[model samples]
Target: MTVEALLIWLIVGAVAGWLAGQIVKGHGFGLAGNIVVGIVGAFLAGWLLPGLGLGLSGIVGSIIYAALGAIILLLLIGLIKRA
Candidate 1:
């Protein structure tokens, strides 16, 4: 992808990660960590949502989609840690 696309992905990932951290609570992984989480979450959502017949569009949709994925990711991590 181009630099612009990469930058957009990073920004979306950061925002999604922050939102997920806030929603999930006690799962904040700082900026870099959040970006990673968000990007992974986006991928997770991209894979899962379409299968579920759910698809989001536009920047806001992207953020929401990624945030949802990030939330799930954090929850799984929490569960794994507890176990």
Candidate 2:
């Protein structure tokens, strides 16, 4: 990826990961975990949202969607652990 793309991804990942942690009511993971979540969540979000006819555009949009996805995954994991 270009430097610009990488920078954008970093920014998006930071915001999205923190937001995901907040949504799931869990302590935010360290920077590395956040990066993993944010990047993976971006793809997950892109896959899932389309089923509902929702979409994200640009870095901000993608980050928002990705964050939501990461939150869902975190929440699900919490539920599974509690069971």
Candidate 3:
């Protein structure tokens, strides 16, 4: 990817991660972890939502998608922990 694209991705990743962190709450997976979760969350969102004709696009979209996916992931984690 181009330098600009890479930068954009990083910016998106950071924002998405922050949003995800907010939705998930507590746990607080640090900045790096947030980026990782955000990246993975982006893919997860793309996979789950788009199949239903509902994927977010662009930076803000990615952030929203990531937050939602993060919420799902956190809920799953919570359920697994309880069980």
Q: Which pairs of residues clash in candidate 2, taking residues 3 or more apart in a chain or in different chains? A: none
Error of 3 at 17 (Å): 2.0
lDDT of 1 by residue, 1-83 (tens): 99999999999999999999988985577999889999999999998888988888999999999998999898899899999
RMSD (Cα, Å) of model 2: 1.5
The 10-residue segment with the lowest total lDDT in model 1 = 20-29
- lDDT score of residue 62 within candidate 1: 98
lDDT (0-100) at residue 25 of candidate 1? 87
**TM-score of every model?**
0.93, 0.85, 0.76
Runs in model 1 deviating more than 4 A are none
Give candidate 2 regions above 4 Å deviation.
none
lDDT of 3 by residue, 1-83 (tens): 89998777676666777776776675557778777777777667777887788865677776788767666766677799999
**RMSD for each model, in Å, please?**
1.2, 1.5, 2.0
Report, for every candidate in turn, its global Cα lDDT versus the true structure. 0.92, 0.82, 0.72
Per-residue lDDT over 1-83 for candidate 2, one digit per residue giving the tens place of the 0 to 100 score: 89998988887887888889866776778888888887777777878888999986887788899898788777778899999
Worst 10-residue lDDT window for candidate 2 reads 21-30
